[model samples]
Target: MKIISFGVNNFRGITGGLENNTIEFNNSNTIFLLGQNNVGKSSFLKAYEFFYKNTSAAVEDIYRMNPENVIEFELVLQLDEFDFQKDSIANKKEGLKKWLNPDNLLKIKRVLKPKIGAKISFEKTENYTWDYEQNGWVAKNYGGIGLDTVFQAALPTPIFIKAMPTEAEGEAIINEILKQKANANLEDKDRLELKEAQAKIQELQDKLYNPESIQSYKEEVNKYFQSLFPNTKIELSEKDKTKWTENSIGKSFAIHFEQNNNGEKDETIPTSHERIGHGAVRSAIFSLLLMKDVAEEFERVDNRKDYIVLFEEPELFLHPKLMKQLRTLIYKVSETDTPYQVLCASHSPQMIDITKEKSSLVRMTKHNEGTRLFQINDEFLKDSKEIKTKEELKQEMNEILRFNPFICESFYADEVVLIEGPTEEIILRGYFNEVQIDKDIFIVNCGTVNNIPFFQKIFSRFNIKYHVICDSDAAEVKELDNYGLIPFETGIQKSIYQQLKSDYEKVDYSVGLFHVNVPTFEPSHQQESIKDNLKYSNNYLASDGKPYNENLYWKDVLKPNLNSEEINTVPIVKFLKNIVDHN
Candidate 1:
């Protein structure tokens, strides 16, 4: 079973004020949570952990703000034949299989309303009724095994890899696997009869420590010792009595890292998991998770185990190059024969595969108003296949990856300014600097006028209000690249901003999309609205065979003139400022 959708209410940050929140996931794809800090991204992942890891979480734990308050959380899962076949899953399959919705999906709900107020548990969501006083769900099928038995026993165990102590996590993971192996060996009577072996050891001890010829030696010796010294009487103890048990052997193992570089007979240097670098440790842990999940899936005879790995800020301590490698690894592992799902809560674009269709992306945002989430529909993903063929898409992705740090920088910024081509990105960055506006506004190169929607969708998904500046490539429309066209969309909008505002109910796009009222962005841009003299200055500055720097024109321009409305650059600055101010 894989998560199809998750809903939470009266949980932290999301509901100390907000009303309700739900994040629906796409199956068989990477589900990315894109948002700024303090949003429901982490809370959403925690819901998965709570439901799977701590099914019996206390009432006060989940609804910590108030134990008496009602709390509601729901999970919709896409099930398969294997889900019903497993014993633990089979037990819980009662009353649930019949409850599968029209889509053949299972919706399990946890609700404590009107004061059941004890602990977290599984209850059938089938016949639940709303209680106005408690303002939460009241499950009709109370105190039952609707979907309880499949908690990691039959369902995919949810694992977390946050931005802390990754090496130690790896160590813990390795130790647990080793213990599981040891316990299996101790319990498998067909492989090694532990009880019989314990009996044989006892016989051997009798021969060595107790003289079998003198049958009553232990009793006779104890009696004599008791007479000699009442409290100091001795008894023969078997040393290996507990050796063959699972717990005894499981506790005996420990992992150590040691190395000796010199060829000379130097003492080996021993080290703990702490010595490893953060990136190395994170990579190691991630690799181990991938390997183990795949192995677990394949090794299972009856039910294939599906594992969902959660990573929060996966790019925390890694370089841009490493981020790309790690992102690629996530997709590769999910695509393997192993049944796996990867969820990432990230603020770094490098950690996300942007080229992948939006169905894989979920945008989360929080504010005093409330937290809202939006995910792309399957229609957009299907439409993209026609827009770019497989080979072309791969090449585009590779090129975008080359500038991972620069491309993904918008994710970290407070405001995003998405413009067509590198020229606009450079110009806007220079323009922002020239005016000396100290803002966390990042300019993203959208590459083409047609591609404006592709990026705007991403920005809006993360709840980042973005202002788009695109060239009116009308004259070159036939020759221009086609990207902004989605399936549900009939044709290109005369004003993409108007279209965007209509398309999404979330963002107010009145000032978001700004199409330069000109034919093109180069000479037309220099001639029209702004009449930028920098274009002339750039030509004069260029002398060598080398190309002119896009940012070079602004070098000699003073800040005061750029700020002055009388100056030529004011229109551009004001336009950029309005985008920021409005948001």
Candidate 2:
């Protein structure tokens, strides 16, 4: 069984009911929850935890601490034939099978209306299940089982990895990994060693908890206690327990790192787990969560349990290279035979992988009505037959995004500035630096003027406000080396900015288009002599022997002219300032 969608109301900053605040899961195994802070990304994950645990809530859990408010959680679960066949409870299995919708989905809701002036608890909470015939949640006659019972007994549990995990939590995760390793199948030599170790532990337990030793320890405790109260008698009872459970034994285990200099005995040293850096500790915890061996064990079982991993700020303490590695590992684990879904509330663009068909990006925003969600649709060019096929457009997007992580940051921005090349990106960054305009604006270098329209299609599909800034030119189109032209969009190239505005005029949405009246950007508002120098400067290449350093134009040609008061009034600069002011 897997979660199809979750809804929350009056829980933390989420004040809207399920009707207004439902988050539907995507088809991909990994889903990225993108948002700025305080938009309820963490709160949404906690609501999933609450649905599974059904723990007590605090007064503050109510939205805005209103005493009259009630917290509600709703979940729609998707189940298959395998789920029904593996059920151990015959009664519940039959009832659930009968209650299942035609599409094999079940919607269950938990409502907690806190009692006035009493402890907040789930004892009096209302539970309901969606009825297909009625088309609403039905509280009574649920095939002899309540929604809470089915939800708890049938649904899969989630594993939540917090942003800042405590040391004890880290140890607990490591112990879980070790415990799985111990229980997994082993070779003859390892089996022999494990048995021998267990036998020795048993011997120690027998000596420590025997009747004679218990009597002696009891006398020692009572001797000290009796001195404080002369007339009182202390009694000690022995249950004859001598064996330690697997959890108890695991608690005694500790993780250590070893350092040595190529087989030199003098340099050998052991570093305790506590002494390790936080980055190393977090890496170790998440690395163990891959559970390759445990996944194999799961494959062998007929009734495998499913899990959804909730990770908050997975790039908390890791460097860029490590963040890439961690992101790769997450996708690797999800693709395995083990049933797992990974969702992360992340701020790093490095953690995003929208190239995958199943991967999805959802943005959360706060408003007068509370937190609302927006998702990027997979089919952006489905109806765009005039330009290119959907598959071709998608392939182009994936190829460019694979090599450019900076462009991926546009998914998190409140407003975007789409430029033609790195020259524009550098100039905009410099402009924003000179005049500090506070806004969550992301400038994406589309690599070429023609491709700006494709990216505009993306922002339009996701309802993200964006501005397009490209040159106004009429030149003979040339075939590029790195990229191919969109079919039917070639032949003779006119002003691409004007064509973009014409296309957006037909749509219900509006796009901000900023372009200079001059033929190209290099000569915009420049004198004839400076324009000649700008053209000549493009001939010189940097030390790396690639295309001329894009920054060279910014520092040598653009910077000096930008200082002039007249240059600040250029169309591109003024348009950028407007974006920062309005957004």
Best by TM-score: 2
Q: Report residue 531 deviation for candidate 2 (angstroms).
A: 12
lDDT of 2 by residue, 525-555 (tens): 3534343434325443424432344456556
How well does candidate 2 score on lDDT at residue 353?
69
- Give lDDT tens digits, candidate 1, residues 417-495: 7776765666676777656656677888766666666666656655566776665554333322232322122234344
After superposition of all CA atoms, the RMSD between model 1 and the true structure is 12.9
Deviation in Å, model 2, residue 188 alpha carbon: 23
**Candidate 2, RMSD to the unseen true structure:** 12.1
Cα distance off (Å), candidate 1, residue 543: 8.1
Task: State model 2's lDDT.
Answer: 0.61
RMSD, each candidate, Å? 12.9, 12.1
| Error of model 2, residue 79, in angstroms | 1.2
| lDDT: worst 10-residue window of model 2 | 483-492
Prediction 2 TM-score vs. true: 0.73
TM-score of each: 0.71, 0.73
Model 1 lDDT, full chain set: 0.54
Which lDDT values do the candidates have, in the order given?
A: 0.54, 0.61
CA lDDT, candidate 1, residue 194: 35
**TM-score result, candidate 1:** 0.71
